[model samples]
Target: MTQKTMSSLQRVLTSLSHKEPDRVPFFLLTTMHGAKELGISIEQYFSQARNVVEGQLRMREKYRHDCYYSFFYAPIEVEAWGGEVLFYDDGPPNSGAPIIRNAENIKHLTPPKIEETPCLLKVLEATRLLKNEVGDDAPIIGVAMSPYSLPVMQMGFDNYIELMLDQPDLFAQLMKVNEAFCIAWSNAQLEAGATAICYFDPVSSTTITPREMYLKTGFNVARQTLAQIKGPTATHMASGRCLPIVEDLANTGTAIIGVSVLEDLAELKSACRGKLTVLGNLNGIEMRRWTLEQAESKVKDAIARAGSGGGFILSDNHGEIPWQVSDEILMAISEAVHKWGKYPLTWLEDHG
Candidate 1:
């Protein structure tokens, strides 16, 4: 619909993959507050498909940041598996009950066929709208659940973990089914014109045994789903330090790994080497609590430490910052990265 010389998404994607750019990229992970701050209501935006697309377009124009997520969430994956959700006024939707409570319930589980599921179809439409409207100005990143997380949707967290310990075979079978669902779902987004798919598999990193990560999930289903996609794929590890499994994860060969606070961003960069890109670890709460200058400084520091070799893209260490994060503070963080972040150790002298 509109055109610009250089947009945020293109810059970040190029730099993070180790290519040179006009400058280091400034990428903000969007949250409810970011939308509201831009004059859109979070409730109204996420509820409707057009609203979601407009909201993202508005964000890119306002912040001029490098990338934006597709405004889709992991709960949608559970919904595809026949799970129900209860929405709230304040935060994300929560799954009401596991679709597959018992092994026998597996028979009833069917992945939502794209046309048949209104919620999912809405996302596909939103993605198409974004890809067409934004074009190359910004890269639209899609999301899919890790095979490990699908079980938590089918069977609650406690049940899924116990099954991993007790009935390993059933767990693997469930993962395979979910993996197929992911391949289909992610491909739908890619075909819809997404530049990349952001895969969330916090459960595997947080709860499962490393044995499960390696022998069962890592080398098998997760790799299989990643292999199915032609475009870039990113895996977001939600919980604490997933460092131990980072190498095995790198072996899966996704293009980016989204890191949380538990992860040492520097170590993650070192481990992935040239094989993968590291996305975040900004500590959202800290960003809110500290002064804008302090927050900006932290962002600069993270970029310098993690982005040194060039595969690091900046984002908060955790989920979206709360709705109260001030526009000035947000702007400060965004501006700091673009101003201070550069190649060949931009902040090295300041740090030393």
Candidate 2:
């Protein structure tokens, strides 16, 4: 085999530019795995920027993955709005209570300043450390929850759904506040040297909301929020099906879209062929039980389906590596990508 040539950042950028690079880049999205590497609990690992950065560096060194996940638990963003975060031994953190209770509260809320938020500051610091140490070699991915989706934590999901349907104006008000925070926070990461922001907008998916509802609320809010961010971006709807709105997703000025396992990878690749890079489809929940051979087969299949061109990043459907996934399985997936994801995938053209 030929010696690999591109840095992970260059590899990813080349793919994003819609051309084959040396190989397909992979982002394992190993949030908790980093904590596991340090022999510490996820909660303690997240408490310090140095610990998070050290763990991320170690993970990349061991796995040969392409990205630095300069991210914290999902609810840290909610913490900025005064929500309490309760961490777990097996997964990401969750909110203790909904910060916004009444519809009227939405109208009066002010977006929190970065300096005023402790956990968010730690995340940014971790990003800065990654940039200083390894930004030249790999892409540092930052995440910003979409204004339309932050309500899943700002208030409870059921409450958000009721408000979204019953009081559209109040929903719009909440979006305005979230929009400001999302833009500011995302731009801050870019300023700190993140390659792109992952615009995580799960509730906007067709599985969760109707087409008309998204176009009216989530779509418009995402467009506005994504437009104002300072750097490149990827719009991800977590594990929700995106095929119905694939074109709509492509139109959001994002360079990539994270697709669900529910969508056919080939169809998704065809749908956004020239317009966007495609990332993910492996089922994180099911992956915990995957054998080495099964993991390799999944990688080969994903590459056969979507790796023909230059716009693919191998990853999980939900944008996170579940803690239950064994280290051996993750290593197998990485090794498989390196085996089958080389550019000008002649094997696929011949056999697929």
Candidate 3:
């Protein structure tokens, strides 16, 4: 029997449920690259809600990838807490400095009010606009920094590790404040029209810290925060290795988790087989220099490794495409995925 054609929504949903649809669902995850497409500076592209929505629409037109990413730079969230955010000529903005100066600061820390934060409000408005425009067309993914991982921005990496190890109580206090902020911010996006929220937690990866550390702090925070989120969510570890902690991540109530390029894709798929969906392993950092052939080969290999069943969503590993990646390579990747990503993937044996 022949299968019926599926919409992008059906494709992603079927894959999320571990069922093969007509084709494998994939998204480009072109975050700041959208700004690059608009021929505008990152600062200008993110200045207004319409600019982001327009960039997304144009990005889809050019790449034709599934899923609309309704996200702004991550550090913008830190701005809500009074952290200075510095934009750039290339890539996303970075926190100017750690917001927390000392351990006592954690005790006095409070969640930033989302409504009162302008940058956050613009992001929420962008989500609402995208939903109004293509709400039924494809998945709209909203992003939130995980409470456990946000500490890296709250304090410097070294300071956060010290606090996590030497002073558990202070870390807990920080998590409490961040947790409230995360839930409220995430729900606001969902209400604005996000299909699911992406919990970005790079510091939770074992590559960033010991597996034991993740188990103790990141795991519990993820579990608790995920419970409070009103909608389905995905746990993403940026580009860091997640396999050592993938099993623990499975129990965190997330529908999916973004894998990293540093790990083996086949094993990651096998590990996530029935538990949750796998989102990627594409090496975005090096994509700027990839030729058409390299782009095609990598996409083909990734699909062949993880696209057998429906529990896969292909995307760049690090979540955001660097602003430097050119149009030709990205277009080539999309073409390759569409060529080999069809259900059954029987073409692999003859050609690949």
Candidate 4:
């Protein structure tokens, strides 16, 4: 079918399957910004399942993008595990004090039951709401932090790193707990109607740990968690540090591997050729700062760099697009992708 004739869900699935859809699918990282367009506060945006559905639907209608993700603050899982989380009126909630204060604290921890936690329950509710409203019109992505990232959420980031190096055995035990929670949480989202589960692992990047350390700690846990997820899965690590382990990450069997703006898309496309679908490279920070012309130029550049065949999704390299980026800029990005990211990119090369 032509790009105009295909539904968003169809376009995303086709691209994930390494086939050319009518066009390259556009996937937004956050729906919180959509709240502002709908004339609601960030607090209200995250408070109700219906509000999130409304905000995301508004953005999809306005931008005509191919995918909608149900992402709230990253700390909900942490909060469910008894960690403190600080909320904000205009931004995502922040991780507060570490729950796993020391080695002994791990003994007291228990895997959170999804149904018992209001914070996590809301996300599941939002997924169901979106599925009911959008049906097959668009792909609804469920979001979760990576196993390594989850520990950093419950324990402070610096503390978790220290634990990794200072107390290896203790850290492994903690990872087991995190891994179990990730599996259960991911499965629940899949059952709730998310077409795919996207895991963010900013901590496992080489910037945070060596390849050997990551393989022992983060990589294995991720593989175990992902193996249990019943639907298509994607992973995002927000640094070039992940480059060294690209092949390893792909081997974990996730269908999509996210590429940050810091990494060269050309390199990723080459490395992930047949193994993983590549999603990202647009710098959300730059998108927020650039004018319409500049933003469109960047989108066109990303497509030229990574949109050669299929197995690509246009997206921001980071977790979420900043709330301050104007709707005009967001629309410009969607329009540019549709205009320049058509499949059979050979057509553009020959015509241009």
Instruction: Give lDDT per model, in order.
Output: 0.71, 0.89, 0.89, 0.81
Global Cα lDDT for candidate 2:
0.89
Q: Once superposed on the true structure, which residue ranges of model 1 sit more than 4 Å away at CA?
A: 1-10, 34-41, 206-208, 211-213, 344-347
TM-scores for all candidates? 0.90, 0.97, 0.97, 0.95
What is the overall TM-score of model 3 with all chains considered together? Answer: 0.97
Query: Candidate 3: lDDT over CA atoms?
Result: 0.89
Candidate 3 collision pairs: none
* Clash count, one per candidate: 7, 0, 0, 0
- Model 2, residue 218: C-alpha shift (Å): 1.2
- Can you tell me which runs of candidate 2 are displaced by over 4 Å? 1-4
What lDDT tens digits, residue by residue, belong to model 1 across residues 1-352? 2223345666666666676455556557675654474465555666677777777777667666787667455577677656787666556667878877687656455666877888788889989988888787777888877776667777888887787778877776777777777888889888998888888777756435564545565556677888987778888775445677777777787777778876677777788777777778787766666787797778877876676656777776554555556767878887787667655454577686
Which residue pairs collide, candidate 2? none
**lDDT of candidate 4 over 164-280, digit per residue (tens):** 889888787887877888888888998988988888887777777788987887888888888987888888876445678888898787888777887788788888887888989
Candidate 1 colliding pairs: 8-66, 9-66, 241-262, 281-317, 282-316, 282-317, 283-317
* Deviation of model 4 at 107, angstroms: 1.8
Model 2, 197-286: lDDT tens digits are 999989988889888878888888878888899899998879998888887887778889998998899999999888989999899999
